[model samples]
Target: MTQFEALPYRHVLTVPTVPTAVRLARETTEDVLTELGVNPRHPTVGPALLILSELVTNAVRHAAAASPQTTVIYAAGEDCLAFGVHDRHPYQPSLYGAATVTEGGAGGLATVMELTLGLGGTAVVRGDADGKGKSIWITLPF
Candidate 1:
């Protein structure tokens, strides 16, 4: 009889703030998830990669000024997978504000929020140790 393990896995990867960072993060995340027993063809992989790409792209595009690199933290629990992107940009977005989705599909955070919430998950921001940066964490329950 095959039984499922409830062990959790976590990985943190830091990459230079460049256009290629998006691809790097995605590849690493896929490998890590697979190593942790997630099927490579899992349904969550698609949305998870999209969220990671968006987060890394935002860091590469907007935070390069104060943050030369971005850190991606990937964690998976018994029933959820979580990703957090950290940068020293000092600007914490307002999660309390109305959703950012537009009629014609304005991407980025809006898309992230939609996918995250649709998965019955939660998203929150965590400040860096030095208080000069923030990490946006998206946790989706499977």
Candidate 2:
């Protein structure tokens, strides 16, 4: 007989605040989910990927101005998967109406919120303990 591991698998990745960091985060997330036995075609995977992209992109574009690196943490429980991005920017992301979105910029944070809600998940934004940075997290149920 084969033994199975317990729930709440966790992984943490740190990357430089560069454009390529988004792709790295996504790839690493996919690998971690696979190791956790999450199906690639599962409904949650797509939204999770998008969420990771948006958060990492935000970190690279905005938070990178404050710090040159950021960290991504992934936790998979029995019925949910949570992802968090930690950056050195204490400012919370701004939410804007759809009509105010420009062509090449804006709307990323809004999209993250919408997709998280659509997945029956919660999105949280808060400053880190030392008051020197911020962390954004989203939890989605499988």
Candidate 3:
């Protein structure tokens, strides 16, 4: 394994649920991926960033009322990159089922599932201990 792959890295950013959060999250994710020694030009990284942007956009759009703020997370190790978007809304949607949750097979969550699975990655949701929130995490190996 490369030196970077042998080391663990992580970052988290919590921001107000607003339209600007999408851009902020995407930019920060790219920066964080660089810090984790991930190649920006990598094919999987592009789709991964797109997936993360969609997740943050979804939170800002749908959970803004109950979740005034959303968190973007990044963690990497063992030659894999992992990240997630967390909101204070209690509903934890399944990424697999999200494919059919939207009309015409087009939605943030649906697209996330498609890209993640298509890349041989994994996506799952983890509920907060207090049960008032959840985090949707995606892990992709580069």
Q: 1-142, model 2: which lDDT tens digit per residue?
A: 0011233587999999999999999999999999989999999999899989998998898888897998998877878888889999888764324225468864888788778777888777768888889888778888
lDDT of 3 by residue, 72-133 (tens): 87878856888879999999887788866465657888899889888888888989999999
User: Highest TM-score, which number?
Assistant: 3
* Window of ten residues with lowest summed lDDT in model 3: 1-10
Kindly list the per-residue Cα lDDT of model 1 for residues 1-142, writing each as its tens digit: 0111233677889999889999999999889888878887777878888888988998888899999989998777777888789999998886534247668875688777777777676788878888899998888766
**Candidate 3 residue spans exceeding 4 A from truth:** 1-7, 101-103
Q: Give one clash count per candidate, in the order shown.
A: 0, 0, 0
| Comparing 2 and 3 on TM-score, the stronger one | 3
User: Looking at candidate 2, what is the lDDT of residue 82?
Assistant: 85
Query: Could you tell which candidate, 1 or 3, scores higher by lDDT?
Result: 3
Best-to-worst ranking by TM-score: 3, 1, 2
User: Tell me, what's the RMSD of every candidate?
Assistant: 4.8, 5.7, 3.6
